[model samples]
Target: MENKNIEVKDENGNDDLYEHFRFLADKGQQPLRVDKYLMNRVENATRNKIQKAAKDGNIHINDVAVKSSYKVKPHDVITVLFEHPPYELLLTPENLPIDIVYEDDDVLVVNKEPGMVVHPGHGNYSGTLINALAYHFENLPNPAIINGVNNTNRPGLVHRIDKDTSGLLVVAKTDIAMTHLAKQFFNKTTEREYVALVWGAMEETEGTIEGHIGRHPKNRLQNTVYLNEDDLHKGKPAVTHYKILEKLGYVTLVSCRLETGRTHQIRVHMKHIGHTLFNDARYGGDAILKGTTFTKYKQFVDNCFKILPRQALHARTLGFIHPTTNEFMKFESPIPKDIQQCIEKWQKYSTHAEQ
Candidate 1:
């Protein structure tokens, strides 16, 4: 077998990381159905997900796309491809402050700040969470070759959120932890929750949004929902459940729980139902989408936007089974001052409007 180690993505596929896998069967491997075989092995994958991958022509054997029912034989070379590209970064450790909500021998939970990028990428080569990890810790287990370069100081990240998003992230501190924690995320057994400030007052107190999300054809930076059955090729399945926390007239504060973490699941799904995230520039929530057309109202919103320049979203909660102890644990982070202050302004404004 060439490689058996797997990397996973958030069930809601986070952007900046397209997830893929390669599995080489052992010389003495027994015949088994592809989906079943894959379900037992791959990371961030489920039997249904594998079947979907097969249907999307993303599952291959010897470079040939195959059905989920295809039986695996000894020495079969299996490849699973998503829009995911290799995200290995050569670490340049930086001295940065990180909020550690909880830390154990197996894992560490970080309350990441909004402006901090999770890892290094094209334009951002420094001041990343990965860079900070390298500086603070001796090493995190990652034996895979990184972008055809040196693999030293590589941090193991089973899943990541967007750069502008702030949240609780669980980091693997050892090879054993990485494997066990990855399985939790892959099986969709972990619990995650987010708080968001979205435009427009929601008519429903709580609801679920389901759609296939893929990269936008025209706008490379954006993702759109593929609602039609034929458009499934464009994206993977994503599901989010949301409930209104407060109705702030023009915008509503909502709590979102992800079922399938695809890239930009909350942002795209909220916008699809006509409620874009407040100040989410890329998704068109930067401007006043549902407010009175007046100088006072516009100025008030502009001030709120200045307070929270990025998307009004925060990952408030994360829960998973402990890799070593096998006990379930959950962590929560308080909303940052920016989002909190902005929400306060909205609350005051909406109250006056109601009166």
Candidate 2:
């Protein structure tokens, strides 16, 4: 795998240096210290250069020359004059195996396996889906067009699934396809379905959950729904529909659909309904499925958990319109092996209980 050359152009056509200064000033309510702000905005730019630039009267605040300590206000415009640095893609491509469920010139649908990350990020710079795609599509035009402030590794990813959740994902190969797929997702025209083996038998066979989800105030890493109007973390509306496919005594196999995609919508909604997925550590589940009369089956369930590394949730299907042709496209992925084994063990245990 090799690193590719990439060019980052300021789409607004403003001077790069001046635009950077304006972006910092407008991003916050209070004025930013001149030396500190420039250092953060311009990568690898030296403090001496920044100070020199300020002293030379190359920086202006609200059309007037001001010192670095001058406070900024709302709608205030600040500009700085400086040279551009050589921009290059930081991530390199790597050869990794990917399951291609469906493919065409415009788009490709992948049945991603569990444990595979979608893109390279902190501490994970290789063996990602983006890296695999780069190797698979070596001749892709401008394969190195990094989004503004986004890493160069992921150029055509329209949507994402959790790294541990196995399922169908669509990747665009061309700009036209990318634009079309992005629009479908934005309009909520894309359909997504997930199959999960959730703990406890559901009381209701089918239902819909509607709520607003945002970052949890206490646990910054997780999202939680706010029930009050005064909550500072107001979230966007999310809707999820679910139906039980089968019930196996203590566990239920279910299918979920998303009307609005928010982070962890299905998982959170299920937890809200008091039916978290089996083996989901984040939500909570039975630590042990023991003490049952079916001793053999209980052992099987225990073994299943010991072997399975993540929650028993799978992205079963994805449907959307073709980005370039405007034609309907749909893809499905079978449940992964670990989840299937858990379901089988539950079925066996249920039959034993009946006897």
Per-model TM-score, in order, reads 0.74, 0.71
Please give, for residues 218-252, the per-residue lDDT of candidate 2 as tens digits.
45445777657554234667889999999888789
Candidate 1's TM-score reads 0.74
Compose the digit string of candidate 1's lDDT tens values, residues 1-355.
Answer: 2232244443366553233456666554567899987765543456788899899877879877899999998778887766655443345778899898988777989999998888665466688898898888766877464322223334767677889999999998998887787778767899999999999989999999999987675565678898887667557788899999999999999999998777789999999999999999999999889989899999999999999999999999999999888899998999999999999999899999989
What's model 1's overall lDDT? 0.81
Provide the clashing-pair count of each candidate structure: 8, 1
Compared with the true structure, the alpha-carbon lDDT of candidate 2 equals 0.70
Candidate lDDT values, in order:
0.81, 0.70
Please list the residue runs of candidate 2 whose C-alpha ends up more than 4 Å from where it truly belongs after superposition. Answer: 1-89, 139-153, 286-300
**Model 2 TM-score, 2 decimals:** 0.71
